[model samples]
Target: MTEFSSILSTSNIRGAYKSSQELTTSPVAPEPQGTGESFADVLRNAAQSTVETTRQAEAVAQQGLTGKVGAQQVVEATLELESTVKVMISMRDKVVEAYQEIIRMPI
Candidate 1:
């Protein structure tokens, strides 16, 4: 969870959104050169990582059920999955809030 938090900080999200907004709103500004990544790519990667974590947790759970792994390991995986989901939800909420704010702006 700590690793996830470090990777997806709120400030990073805000900065990315803000930069995209600037690019769209400014006609005189030069287009950003391709750096092999866009905001969508970042989002996709995060989502993929979350899915992978969930799968790992499920595997650990199955192992626990079969007596191949300890209960503590399963519990840890479950907790990590929970935290990852919470972080994703929080990011979704923030994105939605930003969209609504943009919509509320006057033309």
Candidate 2:
């Protein structure tokens, strides 16, 4: 979760939506190329990471059941998975809020 927060703090969501002014303006400035990760790409990567974390946690739990993994490791994995899920949910809420705000804007 801290890692996700830090990433959010450092980068802006690009190419998510373009305003009418942005689309209609003449003499528009060229966009600067950078790391090239679109908003969808970032979301996809985060979702993949969350899935991987969940799988790992499940694996750890299974190992614990078989007495191969330590209780501490299983607990840690479960906590990490929980945090990842919470962060994803928070992000989803924020995105929905942003969409609603955009919808409320005067045309």
Candidate 3:
């Protein structure tokens, strides 16, 4: 848990790098310095990460079936995967909402 939080804190994960006020006040979210990845690139990376996490959880559960991994390990992986999926869903909802807001805007 601590290790995971440390990793998240160090990584260039979007929202982690900026404050909520900075994000909400700006018309365009500022790209993190030095990464050079666009918003689409970040989304792609996150989607790939979610897929990888799902695969890892499946592998862990399979290992548990074979007695190579403990039930606790399997459960932890499953929980992590669930959290990742929820975050992806939230991001999707936000994107859709933003698009709807844009569509409703008067030209």
Cα displacement (angstroms), candidate 3, residue 50, comes to 0.2
Q: Give the least accurate 10-residue stretch of model 3, judged by summed lDDT.
A: 17-26
- Say which candidate scores most in lDDT: 1
lDDT of 1 by residue, 1-107 (tens): 34644545476456445433432332355557864456787677778877887898899999999999987677667766776777678778878999999999999
Q: How many pairs of residues collide in each model?
A: 0, 0, 0
Extract clashing residue pairs from model 2: none
Name the runs in model 1 displaced over 4 angstroms.
1-32
TM-score ranking, best first: 3, 1, 2
Candidate 2 vs. true structure, TM-score: 0.67
lDDT per residue for candidate 2 within 1-107, as digits (tens), equals 34544333222223111211222233345446774555677677767867877898899999999999987667666666676677778778878999999999999
What is the C-alpha local distance difference test score of each model? 0.70, 0.63, 0.68
| Comparing 1 and 2 on lDDT, the stronger one | 1
lDDT per residue for candidate 3 within 9-82, as digits (tens), equals 23323432232222223235666787566678767777887788789889999999999998767766776677
Error of 2 at 28 (Å): 21
